[model samples]
Target: MDGHHHTAHSVFPKVSTTGKKGKDQKSAKSAKKPRKAEVNYLPPYPTGENEESQEQERIQLLTEAPTNPNSNLTRDVVIRCLIVYLEESLDHVLKRYDDADEDSVSQDLTVQRMKIYSIKTNTSDCPDDVGIVVEGMKVLAALGNFPRACSMLLGLTYAVNVANPKELRYTFEVFQKFLLELDCSKLSPKVNSLKNKTASLGKWALAK
Candidate 1:
């Protein structure tokens, strides 16, 4: 009877030790498990307020242009936006002219005259291009008097030189055609004599 009791007691200690070992194994596994990482999510589209802010930034950049032509600040900003604004205004005015109830001969006259001089002309569309040469001259005319227009053209000529060779050459050709097409009669008295002399020289060159 004593030996049987002692055997039962020894069995209980072995069972308790096994249970403790199992608990330790579970605790170690819990410690080894990794925590999940947090994630950040972003919206796909810009809000209306964000768009307005960007537009304001563009307007401010254009209005307060820096004097330095080589300013790095202007590199990423497209100055063509200004040119586009000017072109669109020209398009609007030209559209008004087209919409006027004039004879087809009078209507077709401008396009025909431009077609004769344009390196690349578009005649098929509703508002077909008279080439950049004619379009630029029209813009100059729409801007009112001559001196301001000349300054604008000279500034653009300088600016165009900074572009790629293809753009530079195309713009130069447009200016060359424009100079050839310029009428001395439209010039203001302030610049008339000087511009007439310059026009004569240009005509001489174009004759070559």
Candidate 2:
């Protein structure tokens, strides 16, 4: 009976050991495996040289700027310069006409006519104003129509006096040079009489 009891205890311990081993296997199967670690990636940053090159390109573009035609020389300045040159040339011709002697009349007239042509050619496209008045005087002078020239001069003086006092003085000075230099004896009787009247008027008008 003792031998049989010992054998029964040994058998019960063996059964329990086998049951524990089976439970351990089931627990291992149900558990999850460990996951791989996650990786993060970032974009490459610009180097110092690349940044400097980019800045230089921007500066080069700014340095080679284009010109603006509208911003260049204004229309008013061009008009004023043209007027001043034309008036000066007219003064020169009138002086030559007055100062030339009897022996030089033919040469003087030819020279004066050429100057008139030049004035007309240059100012043909000019808009009306003092310039047109001066242009008319040149044309009359070229035609040897001293009476018409005197009339134009008188009109110019009046226009200048009313328009711009500063320009009036300049116009009078130029007219005086012409009158003072012209040969009074060579002029037609009508022209001589009109010249005297216009000279007197010009002086009076410019006095103010």
CA lDDT of each candidate? 0.32, 0.35
Q: TM-scores across all candidates?
A: 0.16, 0.16
Write model 1 residue lDDT over 53-154, tens digit each, in one string. 545654554444444434423431322232242232222212223333345424454552111111112343323222222322332223222222323443
lDDT of 1: 0.32
- Model 2 lDDT per residue over 35-97, tens place: 322111111112332334545644553343224323223433442343464343334323323
User: Model 1 clash tally?
Assistant: 0
Question: Can you give the lDDT of residue 122 in candidate 2?
Answer: 32
What is the Cα-based TM-score of model 2?
0.16
Cα displacement (Å) at residue 82, model 1:
18
